[model samples]
Target chain A: MERILISGPADPRLDDFRDLNHSDSRPDLPGGKGLVVAEGPLVVGRLLESRFPVRAIVGFKNKLDSFFASFQAENSGVDLSGIPIYEVTRETLATVAGFDMHRGLLATADRVVEDSVASVLEGARTVVVLEGVGDHENIGSMFRNAAGMGVDAILFGNGCADPLYRRVVRVSMGHVLRLPFAHLEGSYTTWQRSLEELSQAGFHLVSLTPDPAAVHLEDALKGRDKVALLVGAEGPGLTEHAMRATDVRARIPMAPGTDSLNLATSAAIAFYERDRSQRT
Target chain B: MERILISGPADPRLDDFRDLNHSDSRPDLPGGKGLVVAEGPLVVGRLLESRFPVRAIVGFKNKLDSFFASFQAENSGVDLSGIPIYEVTRETLATVAGFDMHRGLLATADRVVEDSVASVLEGARTVVVLEGVGDHENIGSMFRNAAGMGVDAILFGNGCADPLYRRVVRVSMGHVLRLPFAHLEGSYTTWQRSLEELSQAGFHLVSLTPDPAAVHLEDALKGRDKVALLVGAEGPGLTEHAMRATDVRARIPMAPGTDSLNLATSAAIAFYERDRSQRT
Candidate 1:
């Protein structure tokens, strides 16, 4: 790893990590720099290991050292000599970020071309497709859960938040960087037809809902060789059109009169159930 | 339902819901008022149904009307005639709360005497015992997951956050108000002994962990008639002492090299597994 000692926060070399609190919201938008930022040692390390090309790293001296030591220990023979690591004091780093830096480290990477949905699904058995999940925290949590449960990839339908947003990346524990994901390009009809293609590819497209008529999650997933768990936002779950396009409607067996579980939590349960069916 | 149209935010009758951004943090402390504040129409309706005595309610005119309408329709016989509902304009309500109210409704209730762990455990098949799960949002999500998965009660061991905090109540979708919970009083040793007592009471004390050596969650939960899932915070999970006191160590099967799932998501999966075992 290449390390450089820097004495001041106002240095232009650190501009990529500056005013992060205000600048990170729409970095992926047109006319924006389209840079992805990862905070904390764990996330930065993951960014180092991901497909995205790392541009620079800025953090306090101790954090940068610790991150480098662990990263090198976990991954041997990977050269990070070209990446510039700027070392600054805690106060200097905080001032440049324009906020109290809780994690104390940040890594900026350029957004790469997304994988096509077909490519991510080439040999996958389990995947998650989200619709109208606008909350960054929920989207991030979903990625973390998907990674833990061994889901192959994620596909965004519509009205979903930017998975590359800083908050999503942080909340995802950096799994968003490692997980393969792509957006379904087009309107509602086009996505519905995409669901049809998935179904034709022998994937069991199951829409998760809280409706009493839906089958239990385990029963829906039982003996299925391939699965695609369809989910939506918390309050307004999968639309009628979306549910109609799937092969099965699965419910988690909730107590009467209780509202449904959080979107990510519900998806995790479904993923767990799918994993269990294969395990036994 | 008693509906009083109050015109201004400064009305003395609306004091229970004033400056909530700052006041709701430690309401259960000695120096605090020991009040339980519920925000949003859903949570406020739950507060009305809970055992805690209602103090007062303040909200915008339209939200209060809609809340009353749905509440009365669902609960035909419950009398809410004594509770005062202060209705105000959106601007006045925002000023009193010191922030823009996203849900546009709030209710306050007196914290009632907690039920003993034994009382809540009577005839219960599943319960969750938390230790060091300090985040309010996680606690709230745990309650909602427990309720949805048909877990009977929740018990706090050590280092857990205040479950009655406003953020928890809102995130829980009011499940915290409806579900029963109590803290295990005293030090770590006492709580460890309480775990032993729970075992003596014929409950299968299963500690949830990320340790690779632990048994799969389904294997641990299968055929257990009464189960108490012991969980810890995300990082630095359950203390060694706490896990030692349990009967078995359980882990959700995860992909290699990924960090463990979020605390509440892990708990939800365990709860769902336990519920699934009983269903079939």
Candidate 2:
């Protein structure tokens, strides 16, 4: 492992970790070669193992050593031989991240080209379809929940936020890096074609709605081999065109006078039911 | 429906609705009235219908009219003739709230001394027990989820945030006003006794854990007539003492290498499963 000591925040070599909050907006951000910044040891560890090519890491020596100890003792198969680990004082690290909290470590990497919907769904048994989910935290939570619940992949309709945005990455607990995802081309009309693609691929597309007239979730899942659970933004759910394309509208039975559960929570219930049904 | 036209934010009668963000802590600032402010027409509507003594309300004519229309059309049974409905300009409304997104209405009510744990449990067939959940948004979401998933009530064990905090009230979509909640006095030791109290009252105490050895959620809910789902903060879950008092430990059955689901999401799943089982 290569250890580089950086005493101040001004070193040119530590440029990858400088002013991270504003770095994403740089025309050169992430995919453009400015490097994607990951905070903390957990996300950094995930980034190390992800398909994205890691450039370098910056952190306090203790955090780096603690991270390295895992590989040494557990033989975790993670290697950091050639990657630069820049050790900085806590104060200098804070200055670089532009905040007092950077989880005591940060990692940067080049963003990989996104996978197509067909590729992400190649062998997936269950997938999540999201529409107009523009909120970053919700998107992140959805990915986190999706990963925990064993959803195979995620597909985005129009009006979705960038999954690689810093907050989204942090909120997803780095699951956004691990989960396979794709964005559907065009609006609801072509998004409907995407649904057709799923149908042609032997997937049962079920849109989750709050309407009482919709079929109960349990009933919607009955007799389905491969399921694609569709969710939309919190207030205005799936477009009518998208809804008309789905096989059926399914709702988690809700108590009276309550708004729909948060989008992420709604998707989680759908995912949990799907996961539960498979084993039961 | 006597509407009082208040021209400015300086009016003494409109004091309750002034500088709402800081009003909660204002034994020292703002209106000097320590009232809980409910924002937007929807929450004001809930506040109007709640048992909490409403001091006054302020809103635009359109918002008030829309809210008034609901009561007239639905026979909502809320009488607000004596309550002062202060008509304020949108500019004044934003100035008072310290932000432009005021949702077109705001209401203030004296904080109700919280209900007892026994009272909240008296009729609750299913409820949630939270421990060390310090996040306001999480608390609010739990209430929203609790209300939507048909959980009867919520009991706070230890280290819980105030559910009436403005951010929480807004995040819960004002379900905080509609859904009933109680705080259990004392620490985990007495909180454990509270769990015993629930058990003696015929509520099955099931603690939600990420532990692999725990009974799966579906199996934990089997053959139970009444259930109380125990959840803790996201990272450090239920304290061992609290877990010890639980009748059984239940887990949501997450995938490999993933962290525990978010606290509110975890509770929502448990609540949904309970709601589903009771119906089927």
Candidate 3:
């Protein structure tokens, strides 16, 4: 890897790293020359392993050396002979990013096109489908939980936030980048068809709700081989049509009259329960 | 309840209800009257049932009326004859609270003195001890999880946040008001003494961690008649001294190299495991 020294903030080579806090929002603009950014050492490492094309690496000297050493250790055949690593002081890096701290490192990569829903669901056993979960933090936490609990893939339905959004990426601790997810774009009929496909593939469509009339989660998930857990936003919850479409309306036994748990937390528990039942 | 019509923001009777967003922080100030505040209809309803003395209720006319009807239904003998129920437009309520869109209702109540740790643990089988958890949202969720998982009480250790903070109250969905909890204020010595007391009362002290070497959570809780689950904040986790002080260190099975689960979520899973084991 080639090392470059950047002493000034206005250097054109640093353009991809400029005003990153805001540029993260317009990643699709400027003929889609936008960079997919990974912050902190851990996330940066994940970015390196992802399918996204690496553009450049920027960090302090120590971080750059440490990252390069680890990269070399992980990949022996990969020739990084032409890759440029820009080294700058922490203060300069923070200024270039328009933030107070840089979390020690940052990397820019070309955004890869997400796989289609059909591709994401290929050979999947358990999956999560989300609707109207517009909160980025909630979305990120949900993906992290899904990854941790061994959910195979995530599918986003209508009214969802951008998973590639910076806050979501950060909150998810970069699990959004690693997890296999795809958008389901189109009308409600299209969503219904996609869900029907999963159902045809023998996935039990479990709609998670707080409705007392729904079967208990443990009882509902019994003997299921393939399952798709459908979760909605916290307050309004799943739309009536979506709930009606599911095979089973399952609920975690919550204390009576309490507001439903945070969408992500509820989903995590549901995933954990499913994993436990399957293991048993 | 006496329906007081306060048409203006300058009314003295509504003083306790002013600037609620910042009141919990500066409790020493006049506006920060140390009054316990409950927002939204559900939480306000719980505040009414709590031991805290209701000081006043300020909200929209319909909301106030509905609350009054519920109060009358639940306690026919209690005279709310003179307790002021201020009628205001939603816009006016928002202005007085220093925010837009009041969750349709707000109530002020005197903070009730919680029972001592000893009193809270009387005849209790399980309790949660928290240390250095200064986040109100985490504390609130902990209380809610404790209630749902049948944990008996919550004991706050050093550096813990105030459970009555408005965000905590809102996040807990009024469970903080319904559940029993107390502060352990003396010192490390006092905290240790409390644990010893709990041990004498037949509770097992189990500290939750992500350490791979620790016993599995399910294995640790098996056959335990009484357990005290200790949890700490997300990043720093349980202090070394605290970890050593516990009877056993138990770990949730996590994917290697992943960040630990959120504090509240981790606590909930531990509580869930304990409940599941006890049932068998």
Q: Which DockQ values do the candidates obtain, in the order shown?
A: 0.89, 0.87, 0.38
TM-score of 1: 0.95
Which candidate gets the maximum DockQ versus the true structure? 1
Query: How much does each candidate deviate at the interface, measured as C-alpha RMSD after superposition?
Result: 0.6, 0.6, 2.0
CAPRI accuracy category, model 2: high
Judging by lDDT, tell me the better candidate of 1 and 2: 1
lDDT string, candidate 1, A174-277, tens digits: 99999999887667556666786678778999999999999999889999999999999889998888899898999999989888888898999998888889
Q: After superposition, which runs of candidate 1 have C-alpha atoms over 4 Å from their true positions? A: A22-31, B25-31
Best by TM-score: 1
Model 3 regions more than 4 Å off: A2-22, A26-35, A57-104, B7-10, B18-21, B26-33, B60-79, B88-101, B185-190
Docking class of 3: acceptable
Worst 10 residues of 3 chain B by lDDT: B185-194
Q: lDDT per prediction?
A: 0.87, 0.85, 0.81
Poorest lDDT segment (10 consecutive residues) of candidate 1 chain A? A22-31
DockQ of 3: 0.38
Give all TM-scores, in the order shown: 0.95, 0.92, 0.87
Residue A67, candidate 1: alpha-carbon lDDT: 82
**Worst window of 10 by summed lDDT in candidate 1 chain B:** B25-34
Give the candidates in order of DockQ, highest first: 1, 2, 3
Q: By summed lDDT, which 10 consecutive residues of candidate 2 chain A come out lowest?
A: A25-34
lDDT of 2 by residue, B1-280 (tens): 7899988877788767666667765344444555777887667777777878888888888888887777567654777768888888888878777778447878888887788888888878998999999999899999889998899999999888777888888888888888889987787567677677888899999999999999999889977898999999989999999999998999999999898998999999999999888877
